[model samples]
Target: MMEVKSKGQQVSRREEILDKAARLFKQKGYVATTMREIAEQVGMEAASMYNHIRGKEELLEEICARVAETYVNQMNEIESSDLSPIHKLQALIRSHISITTKNIHWISVANNEWRHLPDSSLKSFKKARDTYEDRLAEIIRSGIDCQEVADVHVSITLYTILSSLRWIETWYKPNKSYNARDLEENIVNILMNGLKKSG
Candidate 1:
């Protein structure tokens, strides 16, 4: 029992460190952030921090991998669901907003700082990112096939939607005027239905 508790505490401390490191990476960038600064953010001495993590690069890699895997897993689920193409797109958009809102710092770090990852990890992360985008493009292609979505350039459509979704980390704030659900619904409506009013 005591051993299990010790392990749990270690895990908790590691996560705490990751959380602070993610925020700092987003703000100052992965190249600019140091392990000592991360330790300071987490209220630990710089030397003692080595006991919890190998170094700063490990933190960035962990964050980028975690965020990328989450997106890939969610896309896999949406792809396998029984919903029609349009509905699947809606679900995907909603999930994107929800996850971005909940993990904005980590997502921001993943988006901006992933390039700093070591060679092998960088290759893997790029592959994961590309795969996720390809999955989204496939869904849009299916929608176009069924005449459910406009027959615009598939690559252009994917980029537009993804770029918009990715920017949420830059500007979104949890304030009284809007919330995650509201943002999700609005994005889905505009992306799915367009701005033209129907008679």
Candidate 2:
């Protein structure tokens, strides 16, 4: 028999493991972080780790999936909320950067350690990742459609934004100079308004 609680409680324990695993994977990477390391991070034993997940690959899948899923959900909801494509793009990019920064550890694994997963999980993860990028591209394309983004090279724009967000995990440190949220907003503004003088 399976036990169920409110969604929060039901998701809490697993979320704990995923969160800790994200931290470990980010710090040590997938090759270095053992299941036991994640288990210990979440206050569980090696054997007990199996109760929550099948194996490391599955854990990887969950970490990556949660990130992609969160981004997609945020984008979808915002798109449906009637925001202009330009505002939606800003909001989406801002949210994407915020979430990726908050989950830097998992984001690293999702980006760098992706090759370690078995075939099936890798495909699933790619699907989610592509969907996430496509969502952003859609917004950019919409902006072009409405003449907000101009006829710039849309693919390059999308790639630049995605790559910038992903690469920040390597250098981003919380400090007085800037935080992740501030950095995200700054990038958003720069992308919308180029460096060249408008006049």
Candidate 3:
């Protein structure tokens, strides 16, 4: 029990460091943010911060890689499910909204500051992101084939949904009138039905 408790505390501190770094990275661009600023945000000395983290680049890489991996893993699961294309699409949208809202700062940094990551990490992040987008496009293609989705440009539709979903962190306010569930439903309804009215 003592060993478990000690490990839990270590994990907690590591998470705290990442959280503070994410906020700083989002507020100030990743290049502008420093290890000292992150340490200051978490009320720790710069030297002490190193005990939990290697540096700001590692923090950015960690957040970017973690969030990217999560989206890919979620997509993998959704793709394998026996659900219809439309249902799978809805699930993807809903999951995107939910995760982004919960980790707004992390997602913001990952989306915007991922370029600052080391070359190897940058390549991996982009590959994961592209894979996720391609899987989403596959779902759209499946929908088109099954006549569930209208015959729209698959790439355009995928781009529209992915871009809009990614930008949710820019405008979504958790305690405001529009909550996650509302955002998910509204996005699905709007994207599925589109701007044109029925006759």
Error of 3 at 188 (Å): 1.6
Q: lDDT of each model, Cα atoms only?
A: 0.83, 0.74, 0.81
Error of model 3, residue 138, in angstroms:
0.9
Highest lDDT: which candidate? 1
lDDT of 2 by residue, 42-101 (tens): 888989878878887787877766666676677778889788888887777777777666
Q: After superposition, how far is residue 198 of candidate 1 from its true place, in Å?
A: 9.5
Clashing pairs in 2: none
Backbone-clash count (model 2): 0
Candidate 2 versus the native: TM-score?
0.83
lDDT, residue 146, candidate 1: 83
For residue 139, model 3's alpha carbon misses the true position, in angstroms, by 0.8
What TM-score goes with each of the models?
Answer: 0.90, 0.83, 0.90
Error of 2 at 54 (Å): 2.1
- Model 2 segments beyond 4 Å from truth? 1-12, 195-199
Any runs in candidate 1 off by more than 4 Å, and if so which? 1-11, 195-199
